[model samples]
Target: MNAFGMNAFGMTALPTRRQLLSFAAAALAAGVLPRRAGARPLDDVVAAGRLMVAVYRDNPPFSHRKGGALVGVDVDLARAIAGRLGVGVEFMELTAGEAVSDDLRNAVWRGPVVGGGVADVMMHVPYQKEFGLRNPEAVLFGPYQREGFALARNPMRMTQPMLASLPDEPVGVEIDSIPDFYLLGAFGGRLRERLVHYMTIPEAVEALVKGDVAAVVATQSQVEAALGDRAAGFPITPVTFPGMMASSWDIGMAVKENSRDLAYAVGDAVTALLEDGTLPEIFRKHGVTHNAIPVE
Candidate 1:
């Protein structure tokens, strides 16, 4: 059903600003956080009278820290959910070394021992069924959206070839990522010599900027994030790739395992948020127009 059509329960649209604030306050006092996804955490927050959420500030399109506050698509959706649950949010700004896979594992998976465990979950996290399998404690909650991927060239490089001469130039990808996997499987070792592996896209772009490679592969979202994340100036122009080859991926809430009830409740809230216009609006604001979940 369409978002408007699904709620026959006579629900009020969106959430009031005040309920959200109260929810955040209650969450912190109770000490229920992102990784604390069991019924135990939910019950704790319920007793404290609010849900506390930890959000990564100013990640753009996903979540962001703005003018001393946190806001973004994920923030909006999360806030709306908090309101539905009568919970509160406590935003946390997360700093990570590389947008690489390993760093992500270290921060989200191994972070509870440190003060970094403040928030409940991270935003803009891409989901993989395989990843969920390996990290049994983690839950992939929703298929947020699919994004555009391209092979970009350094504007100043004369060695980078045009689309017609694509095979002659090598493509650079972060090692051990889907992009690298795709290239290897598709080319059948023909272009392996031209394949360059960097630990992260920023490093791949660095190689490209130094005329070390022809193209640096990245998603549109990743590329935009890289522009701000990198120390050196931007250096990639989009090039088309095989549409069926790793064209789509998932993004969802990653929570600790055995938290089925939490996942269901959070998923239901997410479902409701998506049914409303909030989810699409957040996507549009973030330049992420691709839709993941269907309207209820």
Candidate 2:
């Protein structure tokens, strides 16, 4: 992914409103094809015979590149959903934006001017009420998996699995992530000075494995994937702090607010996948444990 969070697709320079209007005028004069009037996102996708899915790039065990091919649980899930929809799948790799709302705008509803516009659907959206309320332009549904923060500690440096032990030694976390904020204010801010921020969770885990930090805090699946073979040595355990809203949260998919049909179809596909144990099977292929989110 690039600095702007664009993946291999490369970010296109966004054109100004005047430039867009001029271009549209030129295209119209040239008799360029326009979208069918009043077509919904799902209708456009189905008519084009392709389902474009936005997923985070460089996020392992969920969505990432391997052997020059995109492979991860989210990748598989997207493909499965596309298959269920009887359309070809296109995975748009993206780096996470400042917030899920930004991601929804850039990837789900309003496409980045650079990436040929927004995708039909985006995966790994937080299935929370407050977020949905805040982002009325997007629809969040189809909770597929439950994820929680976890600590992976180097046993030689940290004897206990608790978050309180991190003050004496540095702890690693992805910069600007939930764990980063949590640790910064944890224990009355005692661990603030000792918090080591990295660009990503895998980087933090690597620092922990190298003994540069006493522990690393990230998602459970991320810790597991980063530990890999060394998982036997570094113990991963769920961590909690006072005033935490919830230990775990459900991850789902998001579509444009107008694409309720698309959301429903994707939700049905997810249900079928879960019922046949395909989602868990995808997690197993990535060597991470899956915690199924009960359908509500």
Residue-level lDDT tens digits of model 1 in 1-296? 00111111111123336534643553464455345323224555556655545444444546666686666667777777777777775555555422323223333443432334433444555565655563454556766665556556655443453444445666788776555655776545566677888876657766766778767776656555544444234443445445443454556665545445665677787777777877777666654454564444
Q: Pairing residues by index, what is the TM-score of model 1?
A: 0.54
Per-residue lDDT value at 234 in model 2: 91
**Would you estimate the TM-scores of all the predictions?**
0.54, 0.80
Backbone clash pairs in model 2 (N, Cα, C under 3 Å; residues 3+ apart or in different chains), count: 3
Question: lDDT of all predictions, in order shown?
Answer: 0.54, 0.76
lDDT of 2: 0.76
- Model 1 / residue 118 / CA error / Å: 4.5
By summed lDDT, the worst window of 10 consecutive residues in model 2 runs over 3-12
- Candidate 2 local lDDT, 1-296, one digit each (tens): 22122211111123447645654554454243332222146777888999988999877888988999999989999998899888999888877753455577668765553435667788887777766885677899998888877889888888888887764888898886667777788778888999999997788888987889989998898888878888899999988756765667788888888889989888999999988988889888887888887645
Off by over 4 Å in 1: 1-40, 54-58, 97-118, 150-218, 222-245, 293-296
In model 1, where is the ten-residue run with the lowest total lDDT?
Answer: 1-10
